[model samples]
Target: MSSRTQHSIIDLVSLEKEKINRLFSTADQLALNPFIPSKGFGKTGALLFFEASTRTRMSFETACAQIGVHPMLLDGKSGSSLEKGETLEDTVLNVAAMKPAFVVIRSGDDLDFNDITTKLQMPVINAGWGKKGHPTQALLDAYTIRKHLGKIEGQKVLIVGDARHSRVAASHVELAAKLNYEVAFCGPEGFLPERFDVKVFKNFSEGLAWATVAMALRVQLERHVTKYSLANYRKNFGFTVENLKGLSDKALIMHPGPINQGTEMDTEVLQKDSRCRVLDQVSNGVLIRQAILLEVLGGL
Candidate 1:
């Protein structure tokens, strides 16, 4: 293994713009030739997921395999000591005792990593932390925008739908401030956050007309306390092909998935729309995550 100092990726705010750019450049290289020489042979890392996931978990595992690292999957809910009333910090420390190179965590609550990072010798990568942030997802989203549009700065990205309950939207808002882009929110009044500094659009059509990129967010029904009509939501906020006609032909469409098919967007919009970058987001996720692993593991 490389003798470089360890690093943690907890949030986008903790990263410098130059470092972010370097990661993007590394991702670009990996995109061209994914068969880069492995620098993590015989090394191991841990994945601790307290929240349910599909893309983030699998992408991290796949990235580990590509770079020759063994990924140790830890069941945070059922199989681990977490089931036996062990604290999250204690569980992490116990895993650290095994001396893995790093740990990627997707926690159910918004955890402060400062205390945890100070106690560990290895790196800690935040996969997702409640509705606070998903740094890696934001990274890949930005990368996708940059890849397709040739730039990210100054681009007007209108994030539509459940802003109040979306960690993806939260991270994007933070990233927009850091990366010099315009980000706005559009959804039902109750679905939007109570207090945010960015612009909020009441009209989805107007939002589409103004955006250089239209990012649709999944309505987090699971997080909702009071019941609301899915049909009403679809009627008001759904991104159908007809409704999205106000969006420019050159503008890109994005969604951080497990999309609620007809609720968030029409099937045709996700499937037939040539401007949609949902698959590009998924494919870039792997490369961006590979770059992330390389950075934290000191392989780059």
Candidate 2:
């Protein structure tokens, strides 16, 4: 039996490349299947959102059904007890009674996650944790990049947009670095964190002046509650129509989705760029997420 515990996905650094490759290979096979994945879920069910999302929910649901897990979901807003006053721990504990193979939850704060995972006996995957990490999205994003570029390691990837507020950006930085991709951090000085090891670029032109893939992180309005300024951030860190013109032609483009039009990118560039593989990214997510559920729970 595999000694690797169900809870091991908490840190991508600890995951062996062979295991990840197996998941990738499995996801690749699912693309040949005849139907769309479902809302019923398969072996691994999700808690879904503490925050709202579209692609993450759809792809996760699709992935679960494709793997044959019966998905049970609870959107806290539409729910009964939650609106009345049920704690996250209580909600998770109550849900575990039905014996889900796994639980994936997106929490509001990084530290808030400990309570949820601790309350559930089954394996749990963190969907996104505040400004800290979006592990699964990173996994699917990397899967898309590998599929699009036909490889992952040693590729040049430029991450552009609001680095400070994006958990996706933080997750990708760690993931890309682990995969041996040469990663660059691109954004305004105030929005980009100074702690990472990658090369940093204040100007969009400088970030595009390389043979590399470009990933634009979204600018969420919630960041204003923190140290970052939204208006200045939009003006400086935002990727403009002009910047995309200078990017490497062969380079693939990526985003986490619900991109801020005119903020992170121009509408025309998003619609027309050959390198922008955003749609493909979501498609790839369903496959990748299906593989994740399969790994944690025995599946079809």
Candidate 3:
């Protein structure tokens, strides 16, 4: 079934109509409203991330500011007492002591503790939770999909590149399934996620030919460590100009950025493809994240 539910925007299945409507409406009003750099004076806040971040981190900070919420930023790796053997739950719980409207986190591993995800008496919005989910990215992606395609119910959205290992792709996979998209995955054969119901692919041509949206993932610099060979990594499942020709004219291109040049994809494709919305993805992220933080922290 559709992921738009009623109260919670936790997942696609749990997202409801009114909540979505509110989000879009808020975003619309925000666009038409004033120009304030720091609108989030008292309503919102953000937590630090131990891992590297760009879109996910700044977008959340921007989102909160758009909705009039002041931010309390922290560094994930260097901030707090985490280096002294502090657990994720304890650290989050301690941060919660400040009684900020909501706590946003981005951990590299998928460790959804009850104390953090459920306890703490306040809402905990996962900025990009471990290996599990990046709900904000999913939101912006869905928004981008809807903006470009109008509706996603039956769209054949192919998530190519690093299928299994990406928090972005993983979240997209789960949400795509929940929203009834014809979701498929592609990567180096052995790198694909084994647990999902989506169709997996090894050949870029076959994957691109049938897709309405071709979503490439970022190739981490550590593909050498994970896969043991950069040359093989490029040869196995990398995206090149040759693969681009396989896409149908109706097909739109996408990528989660911080792109590894000439590794997973060609930079020119992002620029040359008339249907590419990679920049739009970042722009929409700020709007969608504003929507999420507002819903979670607005009334509280």
Candidate 4:
């Protein structure tokens, strides 16, 4: 069995390429037979999400159930103790003391996982951590890309919009770079992150033409770095219907939802014929997370 106990997927680059490939293979198997029997039966997983989530939360819950693990979810808006005054550390201690099979936490940007994991005895998976990284998303994204495109290596991917505040984009960048995929970002001037050797395109059209995959990102209002110009955003960077004429037929559209329909992409672009893989990402999320759970709960 794989020995990924106590491992936290903080960043994609930190994971060995072989392990990643193994996880992807596992995910592919799980996708083929979601109801297949496996380990992790009778085990419990804690879902402690401090932020609002749709895909990550639901897909994780589905994965746990599919893998025969009981999942106990704790949301920030659900009148949890954290809403009153309890600190994350205190809450973590109390939760960890219960000795659940594993803990899946989606904490704020500042909560350092490197420090937190050292203190924990059980595996602590990062569901999402601030604007830093969402490793699982990256895994599933790579899975989706590989599923459709045959391989992630040598694929030209363009991550568009909200680059600075998107944890998914950061994770994808690291994963793409590690896997030797050519990755670029296209967004407004101030929205892009400061440091990265990869190419940055100011024009989305240029990016769309160059990439085999175009991954659109949501404009995060929660991370409020600068004012979003909707008109300019649609004109310059969005996957508008008019721009579809210029888009390469070989290039497919992707979005880590929940998408702001009219903002990053037009409503028409979401249709079946638009070649959008948003639903594929959602489908792969379950299998990828199942692989994560299996890896972290290895042989326990």
Highest lDDT against the true fold, candidate: 1
Better of 1 and 3 by lDDT: 1
User: What CA RMSD would candidate 2 show?
Assistant: 3.2
lDDT of 4 by residue, 185-297 (tens): 98988778886777998877788788898888998766675677788888888788887666777677899988998888888898744578889899999988988888776
Q: In model 2, where is the ten-residue run with the lowest total lDDT? A: 34-43
Local distance difference test scores for all models: 0.87, 0.72, 0.69, 0.82
Is 3 or 4 the stronger prediction by TM-score? 4
How would you encode candidate 1's per-residue C-alpha lDDT over 24-73 as one tens digit per residue?
99999999887576667679999988788889999999999988889998
Q: Pick the candidate with the highest TM-score.
A: 1
Report backbone clashes per prediction.
0, 9, 14, 0
Pairs of colliding residues, candidate 4: none
Error of 2 at 22 (Å): 1.5
Candidate order by TM-score, decreasing, is 1, 4, 2, 3
lDDT computed for candidate 1: 0.87
lDDT, residue 149, model 1: 96
Point out the higher-scoring one by TM-score: 1 or 4: 1
Tens digits of per-residue lDDT for model 3, 159-223: 87666677777777767656677888887765677767778777767888888988877765464
Query: Each candidate: RMSD to true structure?
Result: 2.3, 3.2, 3.9, 2.1
- Pairs clashing in candidate 2? 40-71, 41-69, 41-70, 41-71, 42-64, 42-68, 42-69, 42-70, 43-69
**Which scores higher on TM-score, 1 or 2?**
1
What shift in Å separates residue 267 of candidate 4 from its native position after superposition?
1.2
